[model samples]
Target: MNTIEEEVPLGRRRRRRYSVEFKAQVVAACQGPGVSLAAIALHHQLNANLLRRWVEQAEGNERFLVARSEVSVPSAATPAFVSLPLETRNARTGEIRVEVRRADQSITVSWPTSEAAQCAAWLREWLA
Candidate 1:
């Protein structure tokens, strides 16, 4: 007693649109030296793996890093440290701070005293 109409399905996919400016920025960040792809991707909330693919595709292009100096790091007397401020997890008596070396990217966790050593270690390992 009921009549039904036939349904149709479109098998085509939609094309995504990206601005030229965005593509240029991505390309620049990918090729820029002294900056990690991880950091760039993190800033843009993009996947590092995908950004690496873009870099690979852009390799040998005019925009690529033609000079070796762009990627070289000079030796310094003191290692640069980056303060990675840690949020207090609990109401503890001691304080902890995580720092990463800008020169070598090494991470170091410091505590106020020996009593906080365990907490510092945990933060270091967990952050790593």
Candidate 2:
């Protein structure tokens, strides 16, 4: 890891310059199956964000592509939305009922469904 440590001004942190070979090696490790970028960064004593940038940059470089081809890369798949079934509720006589129970005491309150927003606000305030 041929890093050159140059002197910096006061209040400024020293910047590290990693060799091209070292960056390529780290980036290749990140491309492995089931590999964690964070784990690789921690293992190499590198910032996670900096390692991420190296991987991104390596994706566009031919040298990295050749190295990546040596490993089996997973195919990227497009994400699909799944529809969920919603529970049906009766519209007639619609009401919101809440039960509050404390030690040795319980209270049940029914509020009109039309005032659900106000009911939510009241519950928030009461709970807080």
Candidate 3:
């Protein structure tokens, strides 16, 4: 008599545990500016969406969330900088200025500040 082996469900596949340092590295790279989530995921041979989910979990922890909220929270004493307008006119001259704005003031710099704002938005949305 021939016997057929039962197929295991996809969800039952073994779950892998990443090292703390490795996970931190992935999170750091994900948090870094000008680095696309897709690129980071691809560099690690992972799905972009999965890395995104991991980011959500990491940011959800109480301590981290609180710390982030402090920086992003719109307070009477603080201003919220939403985004950095990309300067296309001076692309050839490398004259892009990263606009850091709050409710009260704004400053321009040579590097992009979108990373912090984007991360805050992601966390806020997750919380909501």
Could you list the CA RMSD of all candidates, in the order they appear? 17.5, 8.6, 20.8
2 or 3, greater by TM-score: 2
For residue 117, model 1's alpha carbon misses the true position, in angstroms, by 33
Candidate 3 Cα outliers beyond 4 Å, as residue runs:
1-13, 62-128
At residue 115, candidate 3 shows an lDDT of 58
Tell me the RMSD of model 2 versus the true structure.
8.6
lDDT minimum window of 10 residues, candidate 3: 69-78
Tens-place lDDT digits, model 3, residues 1-128: 11113444687775455544455456566775555989878988777887898688778776544444444322223355889889566456544455667999997655234455665665578559
Please name the candidate that would achieve the greatest lDDT relative to the true structure: 2
* Regions of model 2 farther than 4 Å from truth: 1-36, 39-56, 69-72, 76-79, 90-93, 99-108
- Candidates sorted by lDDT, best first: 2, 3, 1
lDDT of candidate 2? Answer: 0.77
In terms of lDDT, model 1 sits at 0.58
CA lDDT, every prediction?
Answer: 0.58, 0.77, 0.61
Q: Could you arrange the candidates by TM-score from highest to lowest?
A: 2, 3, 1
Candidate 2 lDDT at 53 equals 87
